[model samples]
Target: MKPDTTAPLTFGMLVFDEVEVLDLGGPFEVFSTAGRLARTAADEPLLRVLTVAPTVRTVRARGGLTIVADHTLDEDPPFDVLVIPGGVTTAVERDEKVVDWLARRRRTSALTFSICTGAFLLAATGALDNRPATTHWEDQEELARRWPDVRLCTDVRWVDDGDIVTSAGISAGIDASLHVVARLFGEQLARRTARQMEYLWTDTRA
Candidate 1:
C-alpha cells in the first residue's frame, strides 16, 4: 500500500525487555531523522515515531539499558508503520499477547518492518508465512527450521515483500529503514536524511 505523503506517517516501534539496543535505536534514528529533514516551516514532519511495549513500564533492554515506552498494547494507538526490532526474543515469542497484537496490527498497518530476529516475532504472527524474508545470519537456519513456510533469503541485507520488510541484523535495520524512507518520500529526501546523520546509506532495490 502506498503511504499518504500529504501528512505525517505514524511509526510505532515495538520494544521489550532484552531487546537489542541497535535494532530498535537504528530504525528509530532513521525514521526520526527522515522526519526532521522532511519537515518545513509551513508543513509538519513526514513521520512521527513512537515506542510501544506490552506495557508502559521501564524496559530493560540488552546491555542493561533501560527505556520507557510511549504507548502500550492495550492503548491500541494507531500507526501507519509497525517496527519490530530483534533481540533475545524467546520471551516475546512466548507472549501470546504480543503475537496477537502484532497479527492484528499487521492487518491494518500500511507496512510491517522486522529487524534481525524480530523476523521471528513477525513469523509467529504468520505475517512472514510464504513470504520472502531474511533475518540475522546466525539465526537464519533456526527461522527456516521453525517456519518452513517462510521463503528465506540468505546473504542479503534486507528483504522487501510489499507491505512487509525484513532486515538481516541490527545495523542493517538502518539501511532498510532508509530504503523505506526513499520508498515513501523520495530518494532525495532519504539521501538528505542519510547525509544529515552522517550515515552511508546502502539503498537496495525492492
Candidate 2:
C-alpha cells in the first residue's frame, strides 16, 4: 500500500525483554530523525514513532538497557508500520499471543519491518514464508533450517520484499530504515536525514 504522503505515518516498534539495544535504537534514531527533517511549519512530522510491547512494563534489553513501551498489545494501538527488532528471541518466537498479534497486524499495516534475527519472529508468524529475507549472518543458517520456506538472501545488507522488509544485523538496520524513509518520502530527504545523523547511507536500492 502506498503511504498517504499528506500526513504522518504512525510507526509502532515492538519491544520485549532481551531485545538488542542497537537493533531497536538504530531504526528508532533513523525514523525519528527523518521525521524531524521532514517536518515543516505547516505540516506535522512525516512520521510518528512509538514503542509497543505485550504488556505495559519496563523491558530489559540485551545489554541491560531498560525501555518502557508507549503502548501495549491490549490497547491495539493503530499504526501504519510495524517494526520488530531482534535479540534473544527464542522466548518471543514461542509466544503465541505476540506472534498472533503480529500476524493480525501485518494484514493491515502498510509495512512490516524486521531487524537482524527479528526476521525469525516474522517468520514464525508466516509473514516471511516464500519471501526473500535476510538476517544477521550468524543466524542465517538457523533461520533457513527452521523455516525452509523462506528464501534467504545472504549477500545483501537488507531485503525489501514489497510490504515486508528485513535487514542484516544491528548497524544494517539504519541503512534499511533510511531506505524506508526514501521509499516513503524522497531520496533528498533521506540523504539529509542521514547527513544530519552523520550516517553514511551505504545503499539506496538494497
Candidate 3:
C-alpha cells in the first residue's frame, strides 16, 4: 500500500460485520480508479483509499462476504476523507468507541460521508446533530424518530452539506463518490472516472 503522502487526499472507509459491501466498495473503486487514471495522465493521484476497522480482523458482511480490514483504529493512517458505510447499523451505532473515534477524526478530516444506514453511526458521533442528512429510505422513519434534531431529506439520492455528505442507498454511493471527485478534482475528471466505470453520472442532488 502506498503511504498517505503519495496521494493528495487519503480516504478511510470504515468497515465492520455486516457492512454493505457496495457502500464501501463502490467509493473505493471510484476513488482508486480515479487515482490510477490521474497517474496515467501524468497528474498526481487525487486520493488514496483504504479500509479501517476497530480491529485488524476479518468481518463478515451482510451477504456473507468476508473482508479483512486493512488497518485497525490504533494503527490506521490519518485520512482527509472518512467514509462511513451503512449496514448492520445496530452494532456499530452502539459501539461508543467507534462513535468517539469518528468524533475525533472529524476534527481533522476535510470531508466525512455516510452511505445508507451508515448515517446512523455518523449521527451517533453528534456531528450531524443539527444538520440535514439522508439515509437509506427504508430507515428514514427510524432515523428521524431516533434523532429528531437531524433534518431528514428523504426525496433525494444524496445530500451534500458542505463537509458532510450522505447518500440514499447502495448504488447511490457510486454517484456520491463521483460528486466528491468533482468537488476535489474537477468536473472533467469526475466524468472520466464515471465513464471508466461505465457508470451513469447524474447530478441529481449534491
TM-scores for all candidates: the values are 0.96, 0.96, 0.92
Clashing pairs in 3: 86-118
Query: Lowest-lDDT window of 10 residues in candidate 2?
Result: 1-10
How badly does each model clash, as a count of residue pairs? 0, 0, 1
The global C-alpha lDDT for each of the candidates, from Candidate 1 onward, is 0.91, 0.91, 0.85
lDDT-wise, the better of 2 and 3 is 2
Local lDDT at 3 for model 2 = 53
Q: CA shift at 36, candidate 2, in angstroms?
A: 0.7
For 20-58, candidate 1 gives per-residue lDDT tens digits of 999999999989988887764448887889999987656
Kindly report which residue stretches of model 1 are placed more than 4 angstroms away from their true locations once superposed.
1-5, 40-42
Model 3 TM? 0.92
For residue 120, model 2's alpha carbon misses the true position, in angstroms, by 0.3
Candidate 3, lDDT over the whole model: 0.85
Task: Summarize candidate 2's per-residue lDDT along 1-206 as a digit string, tens digits.
Answer: 55565778899999999999999999999999988878644588978799998876689999799899998899889999999999999998888999999999989998999999999999999989989999999999999999999999997889999999999999999999989888887889889999999988997534
Error of 1 at 84 (Å): 0.4
Q: For candidate 3, write residues 1-206 as lDDT tens digits.
A: 22233446778989999999899789889999988777533367767788888865688888899999888888857778899999888987888888888888877788898999999998898888899999988899999999999999987889999989999989888888898888877788889999999999876783
